[model samples]
Target: MWLEVLLASVLGFVIYWFISRDKEETLPLEDGWWGPGVKSTAKEDESIRPFTVETSDEEINDLHQRIDKFRMTPSLEDSRFHYGFNSNYLKKVVSYWRSKFDWRKQVETLNKYPHFKTKIEGLDIHFIHVKPPQPPAGRSPKPLLMVHGWPGSFYEFYKIIPLLTDPKGHGLSDEHVFEVICPSIPGYGFSEASYKKGFNSVAAARIFYKLMLRLGFQKFYIQGGDWGSLICTNMAQLVPSHVKGLHLNMAFNSRNLSFLTPLLGQRFMGFLGYTEKDVELLYPFKEKIFYNIMRESGYMHIQATKPDTVGCALNDSPVGLAAYILEKFSTWTNSEFRNLEDGGLERKFSLDDLLTNIMIYWTTASIVSSQRFYKENFSHGLGTLKHERLKVFVPTGLAAFPCEILHSPEKWVRSKYCKLISYSYMARGGHFAAFEEPTLLAQDIRKFVALAERQ
Candidate 1:
């Protein structure tokens, strides 16, 4: 009887010990999975600190001289007849870039905006900040942050800045006001690339959140396209409270599987608002996109897989750099123009403008760093990454350009973005809508802002 009582007592003590330990293990701080510990503290700050942009007149002059020297060399016979510009035509185009293009004039144009450089996460980030010349009696200007994507600089918005900040240029009210801020994504233009690997879109978004806070913008709007769109979307997800609204030209919903409705329903047909007549217009071009991706995207695959290896090659050869960047301008904007002289580059941008953009990449020696951006973001499986779906409670607008590579149908976009208040099917323009059709782009922005103000 005594032995039985002792065994029962021992078992009872074991059970009680485990129950007490379990309760201790699950304290509130450890139990709260979705709580403050997961959030980054970079978003909460307010200050406008000044940073310097270090560039000398001598360095600018040297870049001009080098560009001029490159122009003087006759173009080598175009050995590859892959896309536009036969060898004979390419020779002339190279000649124009060498002799006729004015780098100094373009540099002066860039200097017109107030450019600044500041350090974030040990890397220098370059930006252009433009405030409205005049504001209404007591009203503060709305803050707008603009982000540019690959193969372009902040220069993309040069023509639209005046119109947005001072609508007198458009015969609209002089009181129309905005304080615009445009940043160069790391490694793209003047912004220094991160020394460490794994600096993907999420990291960039985090840095930008800090940037917005540092600028004293507690609440602001964001506008972006291309990789810029992805970064802005990530920003909205990371800190939706601070990003009051989002305006995008290129939209991607990495979260919602429902966006695949059209692809699954019609077996990838009838996308991009294709009609019977439009199908005829699009069939051959669609085939070409597939073909081009197969041939040219070998580089993308390499960059996406092993960027450092390919970046070494791009860093060395200027001709290789030109071929790498220029081909996208040919196929992406419009495939029909792919086989023409200058790759139909003149259709959307002036020869001078095109060369200026190319020179920016060349002078900075950033082709490899820029390409590495793709590798860093996508080399790892895109499917496995934990992407955030933004429940944006603020106003949002989208300007869908016709010739954009990927189409964001309204239904698909609405799934990920909750506060889509306005959308426009742009009449005509390609991927580089802001640079290619600034007036139309600016007008759309104005219209959207006007409507948002009323609400």
Candidate 2:
């Protein structure tokens, strides 16, 4: 009787172990070479080198010439930003860029943070690494990797870096000071563009993971907003052991929940774990969710199918590039800004800051390469990628900014991030959380880090 009882217990334990092991599955880490030609037989360079943002008089002069030659088109009367960037407003912006906006000053601002580059998978990856000025005694600063998205660069994190790296100086607690690393996605900013095809988020994630390892960090925290969000999530999926925590201002979740949740309606939201705030942001599903997606996603279609087609015009015409990119900044920051004449661009951001971002793309001549990212990501199809299906088991946090393109309920976020530890309904902000509301984002990161550290 004793032997039979022991045998039965052993059988049950074996079954349970297999089930638990199955639940802990991770994505495979594949290798690739994204250089222009064939992979080299020589050992890859492993040295990290210092880099700087440099601009010439010729570059500035060329930009001014393009602005001068930009053919003006009359905007429909009272159309505001309805059609696109208001040509009238464009004139004002051009006047400022040509007269008041100074690229040389902005270049100095870009160089404020220490910059570095290293060859990864045949591409030159550019990143800004900022260490805490004065960390708490007897404590090492936490390493945090932040990534930027389309129409933005590493410059987006400039405002938030000081706050994270030196919280006490910024009137915040120094319990969790950070050593921030902001990288330019390959093909964006100073980073060398991938000459080969199929360089998607997974590839970016792998390269960044290699970057952290090269920088001497065995484990670290990661944060992101747009494309940054997806890449960071993939990093967690690829090497869950190396990622200590993952925090995102934007959540790229499954469409399975996206389609099912809305149909349930507000009455059933509470029953399904959605909060009152979630319902408020997600309700009027047509205007806020459906129509809003359609209205805002026109650029996606263009970029995904034929980025190079439009890239030609944007690359040659600096004014056109500014309009194309700034339109996203205006409407995405707050959709209602579209109803205003100046697109309410100056409400949360200054002309100097906005133009600086545009100039990164303009000077780098990366508009076409950046647009190709859309094609590489979506050229296959959404939700079909392996990473999209896998659940992230790392400690995860989500900050639902009020004015983001879409409001992802905590429930939906948890579907992908199985170990979600923090979900905050941000007080006020939009798509560009770090750039627009640095203090709020920094506070949230600190809050999320505290929770994650406890875990």
Candidate 3:
């Protein structure tokens, strides 16, 4: 009888383990006030107002005067972007920016799409909303909120937005038309910077979630690459039922299994569910993972600790700001570009496009506040945040770009995102997927949305 009782207890324990393991978890939906002073008891304004990208002669002339005043430093002989943005290439870039680049034309380009701003938590949030020119006969356009990361703005989505919203016009299927909403994270571009402290990713996520609901999207899709990846992940965790699907080109995994790679080595990574591609991208762990992180993360250390100190210089000088920001555009695009004299920036992007993005930061004077976002997110330290500990329970799609700063394997991503339904090994791209490879990213999004809709 005792033997039978022991058998029953073991069976009950096994069932309980499986049930608990499969149970869905969510991050708490928390409230926050990022505006100056204490929160008010009165109802917040819910009006969405129109906004336009305007550039005046004063702004352009000031930028040119700064460019003319820039003191150029000679780079070390044969030192490419490895050391940083090469001074020689920068001189050339500055010449074009000062003489040829047209800020007025770019502003016109920015205003091509419908732009709007709405006050949320006592701050004005800026975003561009684009709807399909022609929706499919029986289907309404799916609402998608695309968030931008640091060193980038809502402009990154310009090329990809058209493809997603007007697929048929772009020679793609209209089966999955989308109404894309690209929002500048508060304190980034035209969006109002937070006046209060403690405005981290969770707070940003909550604000963007509120932005979507105000836009009348009860259920919508969320996609992001850098900070956007973390914010969207937080959104899915904070409100899974509202987020129909989550898609990311870059994913952050706190439960990373990279430590085991050295112990198991390349051949046995399969044990950890790493594909051959994952092994190729991650292995020689010393160079690819360790040294690369050390090399690329110098800016992060400063941004997370003393952003204001460096941001002052960057904010004041357009030339200094270009070098500071464009360096990432080079190395992060493909680390190999660091070996090239020009940092291979114009290979995947045009100087006009690149300069326009820089202009957004320059004109807005948002560099300091944008850098503070790093401190706000990292001030408390990593893995301690409530959202970081919880697993996202929404359907997720990951596009593992080959040249991304770090490659996160499907197994590691699945550990954090419980409902990872689609994982694709992208053909070629890096950190800035939408800006660099819009067609490929759009194709992947289409495929992911189809799979997600079926579910």
Model 3 C-alpha lDDT per residue in residues 1-455, reported as the tens digit of each score: 56544544464455345334634677778777778888889999899999988978898888889898989999999999889999999989999999899889999999999999998988999999999888889899999999889899999999999999999998998999999999999999999999988788888899999999999989999999999999999899889999999999999876443444444466556644678888899978988888999999999999999999999999999999999999999999998999999999999999999999998999999999999999999888887776766778889999999999998888778767888999999999999999999999999999999999999
RMSD of each: 13.3, 7.4, 5.6
**Every candidate's lDDT:** 0.67, 0.91, 0.89
With a 3 Å backbone cut-off (N, CA, C), the pairs that clash in candidate 1 are 71-98
TM-score-better candidate, 1 vs 3? 3
Worst 10 residues of 1 by lDDT: 24-33
Per-candidate TM-scores read: 0.78, 0.94, 0.94
TM-score of 2: 0.94
Runs of candidate 1 exceeding 4 Å displacement: 1-87, 174-176, 255-296, 388-393
**lDDT-sorted candidate list, best first:** 2, 3, 1
Q: After superposition, how far is residue 155 of candidate 3 from its true place, in Å?
A: 0.2
Q: Which candidate has the highest lDDT of all? A: 2
The clash count of every prediction, one per candidate, is 1, 0, 0
